[model samples]
Target: MVSVVGFLFATQARMPDHLRFAFRILTLVFDAWPYATTGKPFHRLDLPRRIDQVERWKRSRLAFRQGLIAFYRSFVIFGLYSELSKQDADRGMRAKQD
Candidate 1:
């Protein structure tokens, strides 16, 4: 999750000015959502704190909150699996060299 944020920033250098500005604003909202509900700054708290909140939010009757949880979960899960795939590929290549 943190790596995704960093990768976005590193690529931002090549993005258009307007897109970069929009990305910054979107990042602020994503990072601030937890603090808005939980009162703890995102950097100071463990991610499980936010994960628990999102799990509760997923059970909410409101459509928007549930949708948000679904969307966020998809993104996080995809990133995690992608990282795992990369790690497996690297391990395979290293084994071939030995």
Candidate 2:
């Protein structure tokens, strides 16, 4: 399902360095807690509860990988866009000078 994939994606870099998640703190929360609430004590989650955690771990990992790929690709695209803009501005400046 979509959520499963999403969960795996989130788990990828949910730990150290926090690759590129929604937010730093959000990723930190994921890293700090990869399990579910057991409805018991504040910090109590049964072993089975960890199943969701495992799925999330997998989700995060996949998402992180995809994010890295997307990020690198975007840099290329953005770089091209930036270069074009810069060239356009330079052209205008040159025109004014002429």
Candidate 3:
């Protein structure tokens, strides 16, 4: 989540102020959405509930909601793979040195 937010901000650095603000507001909404069902913010939810909430968003009928989740999902996956790749590269370098 932190990586996703950082990636978002970094990518949006040159975007118009209004769009940047809208993204920030949307991030808050995403964090708050789980509260309706579990009375807890998204980040504070347990793993199972967090997965459930994301599934709900992915299956939402509203196109905007679907798109929003898709956008975040892409970033999350990218961040995960990026970190993994970085670790792998670091390990390879260490092995070469040894």
Candidate 4:
């Protein structure tokens, strides 16, 4: 999931300006959160920790945070589903080969 998002951002030239802007905002908010005294970015966080933060913010009353969370979440789910489907297809092929 992280790899997909990272790839999209790393290749920002291929993405529309609006989409890039949304991603930047999402990243800013995510990274700016105070995870600990070390002040490391959210991308440095483990998957489970990041998920916990997203779940917490999703339930918050702040509309901006919720919107960002929703946008971020859509990409995550898409990446997860896409990867899962590909893995399933690969598994099926391997099974057929046996």
Candidate with the greatest TM-score versus the true structure: 3
Model 1: worst 10 consecutive residues (lDDT sum):
1-10
lDDT for each candidate structure = 0.67, 0.52, 0.81, 0.73
Candidate 4 lDDT at 1 equals: 39
TM-score ranking, best first = 3, 4, 1, 2
What tens-digit string does per-residue lDDT give for candidate 3 at 1-98? 34756876576675689867877787789899988878999999999988887898889998766877887788778877888888899999999999
User: What ranges in model 2 sit over 4 Å off?
Assistant: 1-16, 20-65
Model 2 per-residue lDDT tens digits across residues 66-90: 4544543455555656667878999
Query: In candidate 3, how many Å is residue 49 off?
Result: 0.9
Count of residue pairs whose backbone atoms collide, per candidate: 0, 13, 0, 0
Ranked by TM-score, the better of candidates 2 and 4 is 4
Q: Looking at model 2, which ten-residue stretch has the lowest summed lDDT?
A: 34-43
Instruction: Return whichever of 1 and 2 wins on lDDT.
Output: 1
Candidate 3: give the clashing pairs: none
lDDT of 1 by residue, 1-98 (tens): 34754654455666788866765665555557778677866555688886776676789897756765675566666666778888899999999998
Residue 59 deviation, candidate 3, in Å? 1.1
Q: Which candidate leads the pack in lDDT?
A: 3
Question: Could you tell me how far off, in angstroms, the CA of residue 74 lies in candidate 2 after the best superposition?
Answer: 1.3
TM-score of 1: 0.58
Please give me the total number of clashing residue pairs in predicted model 2: 13
**TM-score per candidate, in order?**
0.58, 0.34, 0.74, 0.64
